[model samples]
Target: MTTAPAPPTLPRTTGAPVPVVPSRGAGPTRLRALDGLRLLAALMVAAYHYGGRDGEIGDAWGSSPAYQFPTASGFFAYGCLGVQIFFVISGFVICMSGWGRPLRAFFASRVSRLFPAYWAAVILVTVVFALPWVAYEAVSPTDALTNLTMLQMPLGVDRVLGVCWTLWAEMRFYALFALCVVLPGATRGRVALFCAGWTLAAVVAEAADNSVLDIVLMPEYAPFFIGGIGFYLIHRYGSRDTAGWAIVVVSWLLGQHYAVSRLWHPADLPDAFSYRPSLGIVAVITLGYLMIAAIALGKLRWANWRWLTVAGALTYPFYLIHEHLGWVAVHLLHQDLGLPAAATFPLVLVAMLALAWCLYRFVERPLTPRLKRAIMR
Candidate 1:
């Protein structure tokens, strides 16, 4: 009848771990795995340019037996795919960063994030690498001015650094995303619709052979970006939406088509290796899907390491500066100084990482906050 004595009341522990909740309209609090992924992608690109087809170091080493490391050589062949990974990551990160922010704040944040580090790389590469090592004539005053805007290609001006061509696509994506932000409601459904329309427009433009549309749609790369956005929608709203999956599937198909028509068609491949755009397309698609799957499965949710984020922060500067400078270093150390390719390659990589760290610490970190304040004000 006493109903087993009253259960003792337990005291609440104030020190219990608090769950980190995502802010309204923001992405998951952190994606630490993406940080490591960014570093890997950047390194892949560097290796590709250094040792892959028509690579600077590969060309300089001149069939030196020491330079023929199978892993490095084999990996370089697919290094260009790293840029595709970057575009997908950009789509996701940009959405995460801009979510719930006003147009002004988003624009300010983007400009702060991009311009300072970009400008530093441009100036440093122009003055140190291009002027002294590569083509002195190429580093004209107008080139410097054009490069500063990060719109050199669209403006019909040559890029200051060869690697900068990707920035144009990135900028275009930002412009298109900005358009979506300004639209009425600006809901996830509307964003998805916009991405689908953009993909369709890209396809139609390519089919019609419209030059203007080619510029506007950027048909070759839009699908990858669209796929990224599709993944974001799926992550945010869950997989119940069949439309999201459909969009991702359509984007993948169109992306492969574009890759075949645009990239592989014009590429000059080695005789032993026949042109196979499908390989690159499949690789990119696989990586993108894997990233989404990892997120959905909560596999990478625990990747909240601080060092990974630091590496991710260094990726942009490393990417911006590594290619040209690494080439220059190879020319100086391997060719001129008669150093072994084995030694010179690793040395150059280490030097590039050191320089990137400096740029991130001195230029990007310092300027970003100040620029954000100035622009947002």
Candidate 2:
């Protein structure tokens, strides 16, 4: 359930389309394809939350989600893998952005990217949950305010939207990267060691029973970020990095175990919905890896289209606004208004996408650069 900022797209040209590779001399060249890919990951997460489960999908929608989205539910069940994909993308983009920059600039970049839409989301969800008829749980005003800082999880305050847990994971990743890698200046050797050492440290933390380390390191999500960093090394420095490939392969192998382990221990589901292990889980995870590898190798250079930039712009806001507010809308249309569950699904999806676009266009686009300048100054 983690999310990340979209990578910037390469500028389009008037001449024949040439593949956009990383500059290798100055700053890293942005990949437009990855920007488009971020939107897909957000959509997958949204669909999974909306219609992926069985048994009333939260007891708020009045019917089984499997019954609601009969055909798509099975596929949506695997949508959690989208989080894995997001972390990988996060690794690549963060490394690309952080390379050769001081910690203040990196911190500013992350703050400007993450906080704008997240603040809006917390405010909006708090207002919505305050309405008496809503099905989602309402928390104390103090809890809601704490949620605004993205620190509610560690502070023992209830998350306004359960999906915000991923943001917490993402924030931790940024903190780790800042303090450990960027503090020393992110040279290639340092980053490679950080990726490997983080992997080994996760193991040590787990076996040694250190709760502080467990909380800080987030063992389950670290490998995707490691693999992503490795992928970025290949993209930035070319494929000659044996260390990069080793990091990717090691992370992929560990990623398999950590990812699939969740299948049997799914949180908050009813006892009736058994979590059976499946090869499909592994396949989807592998597919995510392969997709990142493709981008790292420049195989997706032709994907540099302009609209995908718009798609990237919409992704963070779309992800922020989708989950809890979406379910409320679902109840209104399907349960209150007597619409068919199947019919309601697309209607709600289209509505969420439109809402995301409005938020991005009206608020995020204009405000983000100013926020960045302020933070940088």
| Stretches > 4 Å off in candidate 2 | 1-29, 54-56, 265-276
Model 2, span 128-216: residue lDDT tens? 97888887777899998888898989888988876788888888888999888888988779999999899999978878888899898
Tell me how far the alpha carbon of residue 372 in candidate 2 is from the true structure, in angstroms, after superposition: 2.1
* Superposition-based RMSD of candidate 1 using all C-alpha atoms, in angstroms: 8.8
Assess each prediction's global lDDT (C-alpha) against the native.
0.69, 0.77
Q: Estimate, for each residue in 44-153, the C-alpha lDDT of model 1 and write its tens digit.
A: 88877777655345556656322455556655656777787777667656655555556776777678878888899889887884454553334677878889988888
- CA displacement after TM-score superposition, residue 138 of candidate 1 (Å): 4.4
Off by over 4 Å in 1: 1-28, 55-59, 62-71, 130-138, 182-185, 265-277
**Number of backbone collisions per candidate, in order?**
0, 0
Predicted model with the maximum lDDT: 2
